[model samples]
Target chain A: MFHLIKKDLIIQKHLLLLYLIMLTIFIYFQNSSVFIIVLISAIMTLNSFYYDDFFNAHKLMNALPFTRKELVSAKFIGIIVFTSATMIVFMIVSSILNGGIVLLAWQWIVFSLALAMFYGALYIPLIYKLANQNLISIFLFIYVVTAILIPSILDYINEYFPNIILFFYHLPDSQLYSLLLLISVIFYLLSWRLSIKIYEEKEL
Target chain B: MSNILEVDGLRKVYAKSQFVLKDIDFSIPYGSIVGFIGENGAGKTTTMGAILGTLKKDRGAITIFGKKVDVTKPKIREDIGVVFDDMNFSSHLNVDQLAKVMKNIYQQWDNDKYNHYIQLFSLPKKQKIAGFSRGMSMKLSIAVALSHGAKLLILDEATAGLDPVARDDILEVFIDFVKDKDHAIFLSSHITSDIEKIADELIFIKNGEIILKVNKDELLHNYAIVQCRSDTFHEINEDDVLAYITKDEMLNVLVSNKHGLPRGCQISDFTIDDITLLLMKGENNERTHS
Candidate 1:
């Protein structure tokens, strides 16, 4: 499993370097650190899956002495590894640039971790099911459109349904964070199981 | 001698097509090379996929090393090395990097053997596999397969893209691999000459069925291609006729028993290619019993 993770890194070494450079620029120049950090982490995770799809590496790995469950676990572990490493690098850079780890930095770190987890839970199963290039493009198109329209949809809901907004607004910060973490972890585990089932039933 | 691999009653059907693999069965004895010969879409690749557990088998048993194969366990795969027609490795990885990956994946990966094959094949260590020519990519795949302590080597079209010289070299390596009497090779190819050169047994498949399986020596010594006029062809017993095709008023027949041929019929020497063509294009004599 570690070898599989290392293979993904080796194949995507150039893209990883470019991602790091982009994150450094975003941290030094952009003020929206939280959003940038989460976006970069998500892109990195997605890029690994994308490369696997492009090269048909999953089929190769399936022929090796590794189970479908192990393959799925490797991807999840890979995402965590990438997310942790990126956070550590950004934290160090942010601390050096700004005197020390600021209160906002902690918020961004937690938020970014949550965002990465959410995307990982959602996209990993999709990657396994829709391994084709055309299907993946269609999925990305729908996701981008939804991401663009979600804010306006939320605003309309808030305007028309004040009670829903009030309910969420009244929730305690600690409770919200705990709820988000719980949902993300459960969703991720479910996705992992789904991916394994799909992969096992798949015909090379 | 014991068989290294045995497949029985293996069946598969495509959901979107009418094609089906019908009770495919064969085996590879230890220290012998079994050649799988078939045209395109003849279920050769599909059978290999089923054996490797990359494709699910609807009904059948595949026993490797005398034990039933379980894809989930994957421990059995450690002893089998497979190479498909197309390159399966990532393009970004160099030869050395791929070695690192395999070393972790296979429990008995031999770095010295890998390096030996790499040097023997004259493959560059640092160059990415993406830029490799077809022959080079094939050699690299073979190198990787042989590096691990694989008791059985399953190669599908392993010599498809190589020149004659390179194909000969690879075939030699295959011959050497099975020298220990514990190793076996199940090779599938459209190139019958290569099979003739190295195969101990031959299996012919068509339309997802095993049409014939015979020892290479038995095929060469006992099988006969007879040319005769229509009347003499009709005089021969149907049981002796494997397949026959008529061309320009002359009948060319493939018979399993050469001594069964009628007097005055002309017997001609034939190669594996000739036998394959006749079997594929000619009509088979209907069997009286199942």
Candidate 2:
């Protein structure tokens, strides 16, 4: 399982230089480092899947001695691993850019972990079930819908869900982080199990 | 014979497809290479997948190492090595990194053996496998399959795209694999000559059925394709004809027993390719129909 998790890093090692430069830019320019870390973590994990699909490596992985369950588990755990590594790098880059070690934002790391898990919870199962081609189409569909519905959805929420929005907005950072983390862990584990079931029956 | 791997009544049906493996059965005895020869879509990959537990079987039993355990289990699969034509390691990784990935994957992965095969196959360690030619890719696949201390190797078209020389070298590796008498190889290929070169036994499949399974030596020495005139064809005993094809005035008959062929008929100089062509194209002997 550790080997399976490490595979993502080994395959993506070539992109390390580019990723470091991007981290520098993000730390220098972006105020919302939380979002940057989350996005970076997602891209890191997605790149591995892209390489796997391009090489048809999933077939080789499933054919190897590892079980479908372990394959799925490695992926879920791999997301956390990538998130942690991304957070560490993001901190170091920010400190270097600021000329000190005063930029260690643990809150950003926690938020990225929560969101990365949530993103993986939604993404991994689709990847297992729908694969690359279909997953792309689904992602496109979601992007288009979100693009077209954002304004109207915001208007609706503002009109009717103002109290709910304000309540979440005013929630203390510690409690909110705890809530999001709890939700992310539950969904991530459930997604891991779902992916395992789908992968076990996959014809690869 | 003590077999390393055995499949009895193995069957698989693709969802929404008419093709099905019709009670396929065969075994690879220890110290032998069993070649599975079949046309494309003849369930060769499907059968290999079933044995490897990559594809679930609709019905059958696959017993390996004399145990009826799930092939997907790590311990069970640890004894097996598999190479699929389309399956490969990540192209982004070079050959050296691939060895690292494999070392972590296979419990019995031998680094020294892997480096030996890499050197033997003349594959560059620093170059990414994506730069490898088809032949080189195949050699690497075989090298990895061999480096793992697997008792049974299941290969699907592992020699398909290689040149004659490269194929010969890989075949030598396979022959060397089963020299221990505790090891066996079950490899599928449409290339009959590759099988003829190394396989101790040959199992032929057409349209998802095992048409024939025989010793390689017996197939070479006893099986013959004799040309027969229509009258001579009718005169030939029905039990003697394995398959037949009519071309103009002559009937090319595939007979398993050439010693008792019709009076004037003689065994022709033939190869496994000819036998495979006849078995694939000609009708069975039960009732001769074009």
**What lDDT tens digits, residue by residue, belong to model 2 across residues A1-204?**
889878788888889888888778877886566666666676777777778787888777777788888888888888899888878888788777778885556666677788789888988899878777456446535644654575799779978989877887899989888888999899988988889889888887
Query: Candidate 1 — which pairs collide?
Result: none
**How many pairs in model 2 have backbone atoms within 3 A of each other, for residues 3 or more apart or on separate chains, i.e. clashes?**
0
Error of 1 at B100 (Å): 1.8
On lDDT, the leading prediction is 1
Interface RMSD of each: 1.6, 1.7
User: Each prediction's DockQ?
Assistant: 0.67, 0.68
**Chain A structural similarity (TM-score) per candidate?**
0.83, 0.86
lDDT of 1 by residue, B181-208 (tens): 9999999988999999999999888888
Q: How much is B120 displaced in model 1, in angstroms?
A: 1.1
